[model samples]
Every structure is written in C-alpha cells, then in structure tokens.
Target chain A: MTSTTCREAMREAIREAMLADDRVFLMGEDVGAYGGCFAVSKGLLDEFGPDRIRDTPLSESAFVGAGIGAAIAGLRPIVEIMTVNFSLLALDQILNNAATLRHMSGGQVGVPLVIRMTTGGGRQLAAQHSHSLEGWYGHIPGITVLVPATVDDFRGMLAPALADPDPVLIFEHALLYNAEGELSAGSIPPIDRAVVRRSGRDVTIVTYGGSLAKCLVAADQLAGRGIDAEVIDLRSLRPLDDATLLDSVARTHRAVVVDEGWRSGSISAEVSARITEHAFFDLDAPVLRVCCAEVPLPYAKHLEDAALPSVERVVAAVDEVVNVRA
Target chain B: MTTVASPVPATLAPSDVELLRRMLLVRRFEERCAELYSASRIRGFLHLYIGEEAVAVGVGAALEDGDNVVATYREHGHALVRGVPAGAVMAEMFGKVEGCSRGRGGSMHLFSVDHRFYGGHGIVAGGLPVALGLALADRMRGVPRVTACFFGEGAVAEGEFHETMNLAALWTVPMLFCCENNLYAMGTALARSESDTDLTVKAASYGMPAWSVDGMDVIAVREATRRAALQARAGGGPVFLELRTYRFRAHSMYDPELYRSKDEVAVWRERDPIDAIARRLTGAALLDADALEALDAAAMEEVDAAVAFADAGTDEPLSDLTRHVYADRRGERGPEEERT
Candidate 1:
C-alpha cells in the first residue's frame, strides 16, 4: 500500500489506461505541455507523445463532440473540459450527441467516451469557475456519472469508465486533488456501487464526490455526540446504487442527503425522493437534506464556505433526522 | 442564383449516367415523401431535399467505401446516396422498427453504422465535430479514410462551425466540410443571418482550402467533392466545399416558407440537379426521352417498395424503450469481479 494524492492517482490512472490500450488517448485544453489546469496530467505528454496526449484548442464543444466521434469510431478518448462550468459550452454535444447517440441510433452505435472535469466549490474560483453541476449531468440517461472521492477511486475509475460502452462523465472534486489517501498496491476501485465509508446504524448520510469527505467528518462529529451515522459514498451517481442506499436507510431508519448543488432539483433531491418512495415504511423520521444555498456560488471565501455543506451543517442535519420523535 | 458556371473541362465519364440515376432516386424518393407527409403517413419534422439532391449525390459519389459521412437533419437524400437503403430511410420516416435507427430517429436522425453514415443530426452544426473526430480516429490508426461532414449554410453561424474549422485545419485531419448553402437557415435568409455573405471566404480564414460550387449542377458538386476527398485522402488536411444550392420546398412539414419569393424559388428550379443531369444525358444521346421516363419510373418503383417496407414494419415494444440507454452488460465481468 502507498499514500497518494488524488491528483497523482488521477495521473497514474491516465497513464495506466494509455499503457493498457493503444486506442486510449487524452485530449483537452492544456493537457499537453501545460500539464493540466490542476497538473493532474503533468508528465503525461512527455511520456505518451502528442498523438496520445493531445493539446486541443480552447473549444470545449468541438473537442468534446470530437471525443464522442472518436469513441464511435472505436477509440477510447478521455476528454477534459477544464471545469464543470466550462462544460456548459459543450452541453449541446454532451446532451444531444454523447448522451443520446446510443439510444438515438437504436443501440447500433455506442460512444465509449470518458469526460473528466473539475467540479465543486471551495477554491474561491468564484461564480463561473465553481459550482457542482455534476447533478445536471446525472440527470442525463445515456451516460454514466461517477465521482471518485478517494485516492483509490481516483486511480481506479478511469479504466472501467473508458471500458464502458456508453459515455461516462467523471467529476473530480477540485479540492480533492490535494487530499491524500492510501491505495493498496496496484488496486483500483469499482466504477459502480456505493461503498460504506463509515458504517453506523442511527442515521444514513448519503453523499458523493467532494461531499463524501465532509460527510465522513460529520459522521465522526455525530459519533462524538452519541449519534451513529452510516456514511454512503455514492460512487456511481447516475444509477444511484439504490440497493446500498435503501439498505442503509432501512437499517438506520433515518437519512440526510448532503450535496454541493442547489437543492431544488439536485441529486440530493433525487436521493431523498427515492428513499421516501422506496424506504418510507422503514423510515422512523423524515429525510433531511443539507445542500448548497440556491444562489450562484460566490467568490468570497467565508460566503462560499457558508454556502456549501459544512461538517457542522451535515452533523446538524443528521441530528435533526436521528433525534426526531417517532 | 449566382452559381459560377465553371463546369470542369475534363471528359465526363459514361458512369455519369449512374449519377443521373442516383439523383433521380433521391428526387423521386423525396417527392413521394412530400406526398406521404401530406397524407399524414409519416409525421414529425420532415426536411425535404427537393432542390438539393445534387449536393448529396455528388458528395456521395466522391466518397470511397470506407469514408465516413455526417449529415444534417434534411438527410434522406444523403442517406440514400450514401448507400442506406431507401426502404430503411423511408421506414425511419414512418417510425417503424425496420428503420435504420429502429424508428428511434425519425426523419431528422437517420443513422446507419454499417454504412459509416454517422447520423442526420437535427441540431445545426452539431455533426461537424463528430466528423472531425472520425477523421482524427482514422488518421491516428493509420487508416486513409476521409470523413465527409454535411451541414447547411445555417450551421455557419454556430460556434461549432468555427471551432471545428479551426481544429480540423490545426490538426490537419482528413475531413471534407461539405456545406450545402441553400440560401436560408429555416426561416431566416443567409443575408439576414451572416455578417459576411461569402461562406467559402469565412472558411478560408481558418487556413484550409475552401471553394464554392454550383450546387444546382450535379457535375460541379461531384467534381468539387472528388477533388476535396482526394486532397483529404492524400493527407492534404481538411478542405471545405460550399455547395451553393436551394430548397424548393418548406424547411419542414410545417414550414410556410414565407422567407423567400416564389419567383426566386422558380429561378433555382430551372436548374434543378436531376433535370440538369437528365438533360446532359439526353444531349449526349446516351439517354432518350423514353429512357428518361424509364429511369423516373424505376425510381418511383423503388420509392413504392420503400413505402411497402415501412408499411409492413412493426412498432418497437415498450419493454425495450430503455434498452439502449446504457449498453447491455455482455460477457464482461461485473465491477465486483475486478476487486483484487
């Protein structure tokens, strides 16, 4: 086992995938000589050469759409869109082409494409650069959404994501790049299913991506206060491993969904609704949610911090659900 | 209306008669589609290629067997000329399971993986990048295949058009950007939409070879596409061809076509691609009046067969509505099996 930062893990994963298959190549805004916006692909261009590590123009729509085309042409292409905010420019291709190609072509064509984008708020990148809109992608049906919160997942998800027949979008938390964890030697995490990060029986905190770390911290704080919270890392966001979530909710009889996106139509709302619909009989209390305030993510550090779900906020929400009178 | 009359001076092939047959096929097929649309047999937004048959047939003739094609929503002609059976294209419009896309994509989204015809994207300029990527993939694999992307003049206004043009030129990918400039973008005229009217000039700004051709003449379109396709296949990088054509019908089944005058449509109709090719064949004594009638009759018979196929095809079951959302898990082991 070895300790690796999420950034290094991601770089390692890209390297491993390229090594495994000649068809795998990386293309994005600054993936080549500029390393990457976050340096996740720092040394890749030198190792793989230009054809494999393509440095594309600042045209997200073209490159992303081209990635879909390449995928259709039988190449596994990893397209980086710089950030989730920038991905809005390529929404036409993602929604109209990548997300619809398989079904639109009636299963004759499948775009085995993987798009990696930095997501979430915390780095003070402001309104344009910050905002967790991975949920918007999760709402899409023809694509798979994955959030690799750990070092193992950071290294693991890429290969399986590239191998999947349908398009896959991987949201890498911008802040998690620096976060470190231990990856067992040569181990990669599964792309599907939610893993129990922290097991408890009193309440279930469902979260994924960047929020997983905060939920774990909140779980620790709840434990100190005599509240046992089961933290579920929704590794696969689109399929929403209902089995793990429902099992956790059934055992705990209480739930709190933590999300960085606005709550109105967020993944948190979807999770809360699923629990209400499927596990209502097992629920001892109403499901509570801790989500980002329904305003554009601001630039101010403290305001941004207040806007996002914090450890205190998650703990408070968990307390509300756990302490509710039956 | 100002299509330059620079028909190539080189000798026209006897197979040129085949061009007339194919264009006649598209013309007859689309004419029947118009009648079917009025009869309410095929519903949805049906964009007919009535006056634009030459562009699809000409470009289709230039493309080799392995070359890729990405076209716009008004692509029944493109699909038919690119080797997608008229029966399948008609069945797609009929929304039957036997359609090329299994009826999932009606008229605007015809697709056939076997023919390498990527799709008939409904969104303007959406297919450009996909075409560029297909060429990029072929080039990377050391395959000498050209990807021909067909879009209307309306797509020029889209950011994807500019982005794709720049990337294709910058990367030197083997791509043919075939822009069928039919004078209008749905209801809006080209003069109203674009800042500069010359599309070839706009494309040339990206440093790729660009030119305009008489889209009303199949011969011109075929020659231009052949030149561009050869340039792309020879690793000469991406080239752009602006096929200056016009649509004789409404943009869709519902369009009133209030954008242009009937007189303007008449001037374009005088140079109808099929009429021009048939006239050429008759002048050469290779085709007579009776032969022309026979060809038209043959095309009508083909369209009838297509209608019969669509009429006989079934509707997809509701149980399979979500079948293609994600590919079915095949022999591949589950994710759990990968945990070491």
Candidate 2:
C-alpha cells in the first residue's frame, strides 16, 4: 500500500485505466498542457500526449457531447466539466445525449462515458461557481452517480465505473483533493456497495462526498457525548445502495442525513424520504437532516462557512435526534 | 485557397441528373410538408431544409453505402438523401410509427441504424462530437468508413463545434464537417452571429484543411463533397467544407421571417441549385424537357408513396413508452442482482 492524497489517487486511477484500455481518454478545460485545474492530471499530458489528455475550448456542451459521442463510438471517454455549476451548459448533452443514447439507440449503442465533475461548496467561488447539484443529477434515469470520499475509494472505484455499460458521473469533492490517506492505487474493486466508515450502534449518519468528513468529525464528537453514531458513506448515488442504508438505519433505529447542497430539493431531502419509505417500520424517531443553509454560497469566507454544512451543524442535528428523542 | 487541380470536369451525366432529381425531391417534400403543416397533419417544431437541398444531396451522394451520417433538425433532406424513405420522414412529421426512428424522432430526431444515419439532433451543433466519435471508431477498427456530420453555419457559435473539430483534426479521425451555411440560424443571421462570417477560417484555426464553395450550385456542392469524402475515406483525416448558401423559407414553421426580407430570399432563389442543374443539363442536351419532367414525376411518386406509407403507420403503445429508457437489450439487473 502507498500513501497518497485523494487528488493523486484520482490521477493514478485515470492513468491506470488509460494504460489498460486504449478506449479510455479524458477531456476538459485545462486537462492537457496546464495539467488539471486541481492538479489531478499534472504529468498526464507529457505521458499520454494531447490525443488522450485533451483540453477543450470554453464550450462545455461541445466537449461533453463529444465525450458522449466518443462513448457511443466505443471509446471510454472521461469528460471533465470543471465544476457541477458550469455543467448546466452541457445539460443538454449530458441528459439528452450521454444519458439517453443507449436506450434511444435501442441497445445498439451504450455510452461507456465517465464524467468527472467537481461538486459541493466551500471555496469563496460564490453563486455561479459553487453548487452541489448531484442530487438533481441523481433524479435523472439511465446514469450512475458515484462519489469517492477516501483515497482508497478514489483509486478503487474507477475500474467498475469504466466497466459499466452506461454513463457514470464521478462527483469529486473540491475540498478533499489535498486530503491524504493510505491507498493501494494499482488495484481496483468492482463492488458498488457503500462502505461503513465508522460503526456505532446509537444513530446512523448517512452522507457522501464533501459531507462525509464532516459527518465523521461529528461522529467523533458524538462518541464523546456517549452518542455512538454509525457513519455510512454512499459511494454510489444513483443506483443507491438502499439495502446498505436501510440495514444500518434499521440497526440504529435513528438517522441523520448530511448533504452539502442547499436545503430545498437537495440529496438530503431525497435520502430522508427514501429512508422514511423503505425503513419506516424500523425507525424509532424521524429521520434528521443536516444540509447547507438555503442561500446562494457567497464569496466571503464567513458567509461561505455559514452557507455549507459543518461539523457543528451535524452535531446539532444529532443532538436534536439523540438528545430530544433519547 | 489551396486549390487541387479542378476535379476532372463533371463528365458523369447520370450522376449530375441524379443530383438534380434528389434536390427537386427534397424541395418538393419540404414544400408539401409546409402545405400539410397548414392543414394540421404535422405538429411540433419543424425546421425545414428547403433551399439547402443541394448540400444534403451533394454530400449525401458521395457517402458510401456503409458510411455514417449525423444531421441536425432541419434534416428531411439529409435523411431522405441518405436513403431514408420520404414516406417515413413525412410519417415522422405526422408522428406515425412507420417513420424512420419509429416516429420517435419526428423532424429533429430521425434515426435509422440500418443506413448508419445516426440521428436528427434538435440542438444546434449537437451532432459534431458524435460524428468525431464515429470517425474515431472507424479508424480504430480499421474499417474504411466515413462519418459525415452536417450542421448550419449558425452552429459555429456552439462550443461543441470547435471542440469537436479540434479533437477530430488532432486525432486524425476520418470525418467530413459539412457546414450548410444557409446564412441564417432561426432569426439570427450568420453575419449578426459570427464575428468572421467565413466559417472555413474557423476550421483552419484548428489546423484542419477547409474550403468554401457555392452551395447554390448542386454541381459545386457535389464536387466539393466528393473530393472531401474521398479524402476522408483515404485516411487524410477530417476536412471542413463551408457550403455558401441561403435559406429560402423561415427557419422553422413558427418563424415569422422578421429577420430577413422577401427580396433577399428572392435574390438567392435566382441561384436555385435545382433550377441551375436542370438548366445546365438541358443546355448540354444530357436531359431533354421529357427527361426533366420524368425526373420530377419520379420524385413526386416517391414522396406520394412515402406519405401514404406514413398514414398507414400505427402509434406506439403507451405501455412500452419506457422501453428504451435504461438498457438497450440487457437492462441493469434488479437491485439484488446488481449487488452480485
């Protein structure tokens, strides 16, 4: 096993996939000569050349659609749409073309396309740039959504995603790029099951991507208060691992959802609804949620802090469920 | 202007006559489609490729039997010229199942896998990348197939157009980027939208060989397409051709024609490709008045048969509306099976 940052893990995973399969290639705004905007693909252009590590013009729709096209033509293309917020421009291609091509083509074609986009808010990038729209994406059918929260997961989940016949959206959290952990980058796992980060019996905390770390920190604090919280990191978002979530929630009998998207129509709301419907009989109390405050993320550090879901908020949400209903 | 020795002068008489016949058919099919639209037989967004028939017929003629084609919404001409029956296109307009794409594609989404005609994309500049990929696949497989993607000059504003071209040229994919410069994009004219009205320059910037030709002349479009198609098929990589032309009708059925004047449309009409070809054929004694009438009759017969065939088509059952939403044939396994 080798120690590496989450970003390096991603770079290594992409390099391995490209080396293994000629079909695998990548395209995005600064993916080539300038390396990746986040440095995930720093030395890639030098190794793979421009054909494999393509840098696209400012048009997200074109590159995204091209990726979809390449996938349809049997190339496993990984399209990077800089940020989830900017992905709105390529929504037509992503939703209409990539997501729907296989079904629309009556199975004659499958878009084995992986779109890696940075999601969640924390940086002072404000309204237009900062957004957590993975929930909105999860609503669409014919696509698989995955969020790798750990260095090991960042490296392991790529092969399964690349092997899938349909399109997959890999939401990489902007905050975790620099986070370091032990990782075995050379190997890949095919399982789509959610991994339990910390096992506790009192309450279950379900979350993915940016909110996973916060939930873990909240879990540690809750351990201090003698409130043992079980943490479930949802690796696959679209084909949600409901059995895993329900099994954990059933054991704990209480749950708290942590999502970084704004309150209204966020993934947290959807998770809560799913838990209520599927694991309702086992629940002792209502499903609690810790989501970002409902205003557009602002550029100021303090306001941005207030706009996102924090450990304090997660702890408070746990208290409301464990303290109030305990 | 890197001119190749002017392609041996159009010595092929049958080919020239076929071009005229095909152009006339698209013109008539769309014209009749316009009339039917007034009668409420066709509905939804209808983008007509009336004046731009030469581009479709010309480029489509050079495409080999197995070559792939990806076109835009104004695609009846492209689909029909690519060998999809006009009846199916008309029925698609009427939302009938007999239509190409099983009537799901209508005017903007006609698709026929049998012909390798990918689709009639509704979004502007949407088909470029798909074309690049098609070429890429052919290149990888060592198949001598060419993927021709057709779009309007207005689509140049779309980022995908440039990005796709760059990738195609960079990767040396076998593709022909046919820009049907009909001068207007819906209400937005090319001059108002493009900073440089010359589209070939845009392709040249990406380091691809490009040319601008008279789209108003069927012979010119055919010659340009034949050369580009041959070059792309011969492993010369992607070539960009800007067919300089104008739209005779409004952008779509709903467009009010507020953007350009009737006088402008009339001026371009004087250069009508169909009439030009017919006149040239008559002058050369390759086609007499009788042969010209015969060609018009055949086209009319083809359109008539297509319309009747569409009218006989059945509507897709509501139960199967979700058929192709997920899997092609083997769908995602049930949640339990997916885990395994």
Candidate 3:
C-alpha cells in the first residue's frame, strides 16, 4: 500500500494509464512545460515526450475538439482544461460533438475521451478563475461526470473514465490536491458509485468534489452533539449514485447537501430533488442544501470564504435538518 | 417530370467527364430530393446542394478511396464525390429502409460507413471536431490517409472552429479543412457577419499553411485540394483551404430570396461551374456542342435511374426506430478486469 497525496495519486494514475496504452495522451494549456497549474502533470512531458504530452495553444475549444476527434478515432485522449471555468470555451465540442456523437452516429462512433478539469474555489483566484460548474455539466446526458474526493478516489477514478466507451468529465477539486490517504497497491476504486466517508444514523450528509471534506468535518461536529451523520461522497456526478443517496436518506429521514456551486440549479438542488422524489415517504424533515452563495467567487480570503460552503455552514445545515424544536 | 437536371460540366477530360457526370448526378439527385420534400415523400429540414459542385468534385477526387470525409447538411455533393452511390444517396434522401442511415436520417442527415463519409452533420460547425478526429485516427495508425472536412463560412464564427483549428495546428494532424465559403449562412452573408472577410487569414493565424481558390472552377479546386491533401498525408500537418463558392439557390427549400437582388443572383449564375468548364473546353476544341449535349443527355438518363431506384426502395420498419440508439456489447474476452 502506498501513502499518497491526492495530487500524486492523480498524477500516478494518469501516468500509469498513458504508459499502459500508446493511445492515451494528455493535452492542455501549460500541461507540458508548466506541468499543469496544480502540478498533477509533473514529469509527464519528460516521460511521454512532447508529442503525447501536448501543450495546446490558448484555445480550449480546439484542443477539446481535437481530443474529442482523437477519442472517436480510437485514441483514449485525456484533455485537461486548466479549470472548470475555462471549459465553457469548449462547450460546443463537449455538448454538440463529444456528448451527441455516439447517439447521432447511431452508435457507430463512441467518444472514449476523458476531460479532466480542476473545480471548486478556495484559493481566492477571483471571479473568472474560480468556479464549480461540474454540477451544471452533470445535467448533460451521454457523458459521465466524476468528482473524486479522497486520494484513493483520485487514484481509482481515472482508469474507468479512460476505459468507458463514452465521454467522461472528471472534476478534480483544487483544494483537495494536498489531501493524503493510504491506498493498497493496485487498488482500482469504482467510480460509478458513491462511497461512505463516515457512517451515522440521525442525519445523512451528502456532498462531493471539494465539499466532501467539509461534509466529513461537519459529520464529526454532529457526532459530539449526539447526532449520528451518514456522509455519502458522490464520486460520479452525472450518473449520480442515486441508490446510495436514497438509501441513506431513507434510513436517516433527514438529509443535507453541500456543494461549492451556486445554490440555484446546482447539484445540491438535483440531489435534493431526487431525495424528495425517491425518499419522500421516509423523510421526517425537508431535504436541505448548503451551497455556494449566488455570486462570482470573490478574490479576498474573507469574501472567498463567505462565497463557498464551509465546515461551519455544513454543520449548521446538518443541525437544521436534525434538531427540530417545537 | 417534377425533377430538374443539373447541367453537365465541360472542363472535364474523358476521365473527368465521368467525374462531372457524377457531380451533376449529385445536383440532379438533390433537386429530385427537394421535389420529394414537397411531395411529403421525405421530411425534416432539406438543404439542397444546387451549386458549388466543383468544390466537392475537385476535393473528393483528390482523396484516396476510404479516406474519412465529414460534411455538412448541404452535403449531397460530398456524398456523391466520396463514392457513396447515387442510388444509396437518393434512397437516403427518400427516407427508404435501404438508405445510408437506415432511414433514421431522412434528408438533412446521411451517413455511409462504407464510403467513410461520416455523415451530413446538421449543426453548422459540428462536423469540424469529428473530421479532425478521423484525421487523428489516420495519423495514429501512420496510414496514408487524410481526413477531409467540408464546412461553410458560417462555421468560421463558431468557437469550436477556432478551437479545432488550434488543436489540429498545434498537434499537426493530417487534416484538410475545406471551407466551402458560400457567402451566406441562412441569409447572413460574410460581409454582414465576419470582422475578417478573408477567412484564410484566420487559418494562417493558427500557424498553419492555408490556400484560397475559386471553388466554381473544378480544375483549380482539384489542384489545390490535391496539393493540400499531399501535404497532409505526407505528415506536413493540416491545411486550411477556403473555397470561394456560392449557392445558386436560396439556403434551403424553405427560404425566400429576399436578401440578394435577382440581378446579383443572375450575374453569379453566368459564372456557373458547369458553364465555365464548358466554355474552357470549347476554346481548346476539346469539346463541341454535340459532345456537351451527349454529356447532358447521359446525365439525365443516370438521374432518371437514380430517381427510380429511390422510388423503388422501401421504408424502414417501425420496430427498428429504437435500434441504433446505443451500441450493444458482445462481451469480448479480456478487459473484463476493472480498469480503475
């Protein structure tokens, strides 16, 4: 078993995939020489050579489209958008081409492309640089969206994404890069399902991406107050692990969803919708959400903290869902 | 007959006369298709390829057999030149069971895997990325094939256009981006839309070689496409060629010619590809009036047979409407192990 940070685990997983298959290559701006803004692609240019470790021009659509093209051509291309905010430039390629090609072509062509983008805001990088749109992307059909929370999840999610016969978008949280965990050698964690980070019974805490850690901390806070919380990390965002969410909410009869995306039409909203629809009879309290404030993320640390979901906010949300007074 | 015959192009050599015949076959075929649309024999948005024959004629001839081709909705010319039989293309247009896309794509959408013509993509610039993808495959295989993508000038404004150009240029993949600059994109002309009128400059700005040629001239288009195709297949990387062409008719069957004046349309009609080629042939004494008449007669006969073939084709069964939505796995040996 190797003790690895989320960033190292991710780097090794992609490196392993590239080394294992000639068809697998990484393309992005600053991915080659700069070794990625988060250094997840560090040492890849040296190992894979510049051709495979492609440094794209400041054109996200073209490279993403090219990656889609390569994916359809039989190469398992992994496109790294510097951040989820930058992915809007390539939305046409992702939505119109990559997502629809398989069905449009009558299943003749499968887009086996992996698009990995860093998501969530904590670094005070300002409005344009900081965003979490993975929830919005998850709304689209025909592609899988993975939001890996732990180091193990980071190491385990890449292979299935590369192996899937459809397009997959992995939203790696910027704040989780340094988070470390133990992993058994050759551990291939499943991404198509949710995982329990902590177990509880009084209330269920559901979250993913950068908010999963905050959820776990919130769960610990709930435990001291004699409220048992079940934390479910939604690893895959698109084909959301509905079974896990429904089962947890059904048992606890209470739920709280935390996400860094804006509250309106966020994944939290979708999860809450699903819980209300699926686990309505079992729930004693209304499904609640602790989402990012509806504003472009602020640059200053205090303002930035106010914008995103914090551990205190998660705790407050859980308390609201659990401690109802007459 | 409700169907009209497309004129036979004259610049064609005996070998190219056959090519011109085939191109006219596409023009006439699509014209009949438009008639079918009126008759309710075919449905969906119908985009006819009335003019702009030479661009497809020339570029389609430049590529080797089985080379991947991605085209737009106005793609009858591309399908015809890419070696999809007139019967199949006509059948597809008629929404017959034997159509290239199994009747799933009526008029606007057409796909022929055997011809390697990916399909007639309806979205303006949607085919660009898919075409570049086919090139990616060829490059990876080290095969002597180039993915030739056909698109309109309207697609130039799409963000995907810039994105795909940068990717293809940065990666240096073997792709020939053939821009069919037909002046108008659904009533919006290049003059009214583009900040940069010269589209080749945009391609050149991507750090790749580009060429601009008269698409109405089949010979010139063929020569330029051949040269560009050679550069791409030889691993010289992608080339963007903006073919200055026009549509003799309105954008689609539904359109009214309110944007351009009738005089403007008639003026461009004089420089028609088929007529221009014939004039060039007569000057060289390579083709006479009788030779031109004989070619036109032959084209009419072929087109008649194509219409009959399309008429005879059957429609797809209602049960099969849901058949091709997704691929079914046969459970291949190996790769059963969890990848991650």
Candidate 4:
C-alpha cells in the first residue's frame, strides 16, 4: 500500500488509461499547459503531448457535445468540465445528447464517454463554485453517476467508467482532492456498488463523496458514546445500490442519510424515501437526514461550514435516529 | 425573388440526371407525407423539407460514402439523399419497429448508423458540435473524411452555432457547415432576429472560408459543397455554406404561417429548384417531356412503395421499452475485467 492524495491517484489513473488506449484522450479547459484548473493533470501534457492532453476553449456545450460525438465515432473521450457550476453550461449537451443518444437512436449508437468534474463544497469558493449538484445529475437516466471519495476509488473508478458502453459521469469532490489515503495494490472495487466504510449495528449512516469522511468521523464520535453506527459510502449515486442500503437498514433498524446537497428533492430525500418504502417494518424510528442548508453556499468559512452537513450535524442525526425509541 | 439565370451544363451526365431524380423523389415523398399528415397517419411535428430539397440533394452529391451527416428536424430530404431508405424514413414517421430509429424517435429524430446519418436533431444548432466531434475523431485517426452538418438559419442565433464554428476553424477539423437560410426562423424573419442578416460574415469572422449560394440552384450547391468538401478532406479546415433558400410549407404541420404573404411564396415558387433544373435539362436537349413524365412517375411509384412499407410496419413491443437506456453489457467483458 502507498499513501497518496486523491489528486495524485486520479492523475495516475488518467495517465494509465491514456497509456493503455490510443483512443482515450483528455479534453477540457486548462487540461494541457495549465495542467488542469485543479492541477490534477499537471504532468500529463508533457507525457502525452498536446493532442492527447487537449486544452479546449471555454465552450462547454460544444466540447462536451464533441466528446459525445467522438465517442460515437469510435474515440473514447474523457471530457472535463472544471466544476459542477461550469458544467451547467454544458447541461443541455449532457442531458440531451450524451444521456439520450443510445435510447434515442434505438441502440444503434452508444456514447462510451467519461465526463469528470469537480463537485461539493468546503473550499469557500462561494455559491457558484461550491454547491454540490451531483445529485441533480444523479436524477438523470441513461448515464451512470459515480462519486469516488477514497483514494482507492479515485484511482479505480476511471478505468471502469471509461470501459462502460454508455456515458458515465464521475464527480470528484473538491475537498477530497487534497485528502490523503492509502492506495492498496488489491483489486479495485466495482464502480456500481456501495461499500460499507465502518460497520456497526446500532444505526446506519448513508452518505457519499465528501460527506463520507464527515459520516465516518461522526461514526467514530458515536462509538465513544456507546452508539455503534454503520457508515455506508454510496459510491454510485444513480443506481443507489438499494440492496446494500436496505440490508444495512434491516440490520440496524434505523438510518440517517447525510448529503451535501439540499434536503428537498435531493439524493438524501430519495434514500430516505427508499428506506421508508422498502424497509418500513424494520425501522425502530423515523429515517432522519442531515443535508446542506437550503441556501446559496456562503463564501465565509464559518457560514459555509454552518451551511454544509458537518461532523457534529451527522452525529446529531445518528443520535436522533438511535435514541428514537429510547 | 431575385432570379439567378440557370447555370445548367449543356451536356448533362448520367449522374446529373440522377440528381434531378433524387430531388423529385424527395419532393414526391414529402408531398405524400403532407397527404398522410392531413389524413392523420404520421403524427408529431412534421417539418417538411418541400422547398429545400435541392440543398440536401446537392450537398449529398459532394459527400463520399465514408462521410458523416448530422441534420436537423426538417431532414427527410437529407436522410433520403444520405441513403437512408425511403421506407425506413417513412416508417420512422409512422413510429414503427422497422423505422431507422426503431419507433423510439418519431418524425424529428430519424437515425441510421449504417448510412452514417447521425440524427434528425430537433434542437436548433445542436448537431453542429456533434459534427465537429465526428470530424475531430477522423482528424485524430488521420482519416480523410468530412462531417456534413445541416441546420436552418434559426440555428445561427444560438450560442452553440458560434461556439461550434470557432472550434471547427480553430481545431481545423474536416467539417462542412451547411446553413439552409430559409428567410424566416419559423415566424420571425431573419432581419427581425439577427442584427446582421449576413450569416457568411459571421462564419468568416471565425477565420474560415464562408460563402452564400442560390439554394434553389442544385448545381451551385453541389459545386460549392464539392469544393468545400475537397478543402476539408485535404486538411485545409472547416467551410460554411449559407444556402439561401425558403421553405414553401409551414415550419411544421401545426404552423399557420401568418408571417409571410401568398405573393412572396409565389415569387419564390416561380424560381422553384426542381422546375429550374428540369427546364435547364430540357433546354439543353438532355431531358424531353416524355423523360420528365417518366421521372415523375418513377418518383411517385417509389413514394407509394414507401407508404405501403410504413403501413405494413410493426409496432415495437412495450416489454422492450427499457432496453438501450444503458447498453446491455451482459455478454461482453470490457478492458477493466481483463486488467483485473
């Protein structure tokens, strides 16, 4: 095992994919000489040359659509939209073309394209850049949504995403880029399944992406208070891995969904609804949720922290669910 | 309407005769479609390419077999010329399993990978970027191929059009941007919409060769497309062709067409592309009245066959509704499996 940051792991994964396939090329704003806006693709320009590591104009719809087109025409294009905020500019292309092409064309064509974008908050980048809108993409059908929170996932998800016959969107949490973890030489986990990060029996804490760390920290805090919390990192958002979620909920008999997006009509809402619908009889109490405050993310550090789902908030949510019948 | 004298060649080649035949086929087919729509057979946004048949046929003539085509909703003529069978196109409008897109996409989204016809994109200016990508792929692979993108003048108002134009020129991808400027964008006239009605100027600002052609003149469009396609194939760069044309019918089946006058339509109709070509052919002693009648009869017969095919086509089963949302990856193991 080797210790590395999520950025490094992702950069390595991209390098490995490019090296393995001549068809795979990375294109986005500032991906080449500028290295990447987040510097995840720093040394790639020199290693792969400009053709493979292309820096595109700030035309998200055009480049994203082009990526879809190239993928249709037999090239595996990895399009990077700098952030989830910037990705809105290309939303039409992503929703209309990439997501709808295969079904729209009656299985004649499939967009085997991979789109990578930075998501989530905590950097004080303000409302435009800091909002975690990956949930919005998760609502879309036809595309797979993956959130790689751990270093292993950061290093692993790209290969499977690139290999999929349909379009796959990978949301790299902004906060986790600098966070370091051990990269094991073991087999990479499947991209579609959710993994249990910290197994416990008292309460189930469901979260993904940046919130996974907070949920884990909250789980540790709950352990000190004699409350065992099973932390589930929902790796894939769209597919939801209901079996894992339902199984954990059945075992624990309680649940708390932690999400960085707002509570209303969010992934947290979906998870809570699923647990209630499927595992209603298994519950000791009502399924609770810890989500971002329904407001634009503030630029101030304290305000941003208050707005987002924190370790304290997660712990409180778990405490509420665990102590419901007590 | 400003009438440009017919530039028909004195001695017509067999290929030239074939061009007239193709245009007649599109004309007759769409005429049948109008009848069918009136009778309530084909449904949902039937954007007829009645007056703009020459542009699709002309540009189609320049494209090689390996070339890719991305067209807008008013693309029956484009699809028919691109070699998507008349039956398939008709069945697509009929929402049949035998349709190009297997009844999933109705009139506005006909697609056939075999003919390299990308789509019948409903969104204005949506296909431009896709065309750029197709060409970009070919360029990266060092393949000599062109992607012909067709959109109406309305697409020029969209940001995607500008973005695509700049990228196509900047990347030097082999793309032919065929803008069918049919005077009005649905109801809004070109002058009312764009500050500058000159579209070629907008295209030229991107540092690419852009020009206007009499869209009613099929030969002019064909020659321009050939020249542009050659330049693109030779790695010169993208080229934009503003085919000055008009749609005789309403934008779609639902359009009342209250924007223009009957006189305006009549004036443009006097310079009808099909009639102009046929007249030129006759004047050159290439096609007599009897041969013209035969061509019309043949076109009508083909359209009749297409209608019969569409009428006999089957409806796709509801159980298979969820298929193709994500490609079925049950049998094949991707590269990741091998690596693991």
Window of ten residues with lowest summed lDDT in model 1 chain A: A184-193
TM-scores for chain A over all candidates: 0.98, 0.96, 0.97, 0.99
Q: Write the per-residue lDDT of candidate 2 for residues B1-340, one digit (tens) a residue.
A: 4432244457557557888888989988888888888888888888877778878888887888899999888888988888887877788788775667655666788877778888888778877877777787787667888898999888899877877888788777889998888887888878899888767777888887888878877777778888887888888889998888888888888888988888888999898888888888888878899999998988888888877887788897766565555553344454222221
lDDT of each residue in A1-326, candidate 4, tens digit only: 89999999999999999999999999999999999999999999999999999899999999999999999999999999999999999998899889898888888989999999999989999999988888999998889999999999999999999998889999999889999999989767688889999999999999999999888888999899999999999999977889899999999999999999998999999999999999999999999989999999999999998999999999887878777873
Question: DockQ of every model listed?
Answer: 0.59, 0.38, 0.35, 0.58
Docking class of 4: medium
lDDT of 4 at A145: 94
Off by over 4 Å in 4: B1-11, B331-340
Residue A250 displacement in candidate 4 (angstroms)? 0.7
CA displacement after TM-score superposition, residue B287 of candidate 4 (Å): 0.7
What are the lDDT figures for the candidates, one per model? 0.89, 0.82, 0.81, 0.91
Model 1 CAPRI quality: medium
Tens-place lDDT digits, model 2, residues A1-25 = 6789999989988999999998899
Residue B85, candidate 1: C-alpha displacement in angstroms: 1.0
Native contact fraction per model: 0.75, 0.42, 0.45, 0.72
| Candidate 2 or 1, higher DockQ | 1
Each candidate's TM vs. the true structure?
A: 0.97, 0.87, 0.90, 0.97
| Collision count for each candidate, in order | 0, 3, 4, 0
- Under CAPRI classification, how is model 2 graded? acceptable
When sorted by lDDT, best at the front, the candidate numbers are 4, 1, 2, 3
Model 4, residue pairs in steric clash = none
Q: By the TM-score metric, which is better: model 1 or model 2?
A: 1
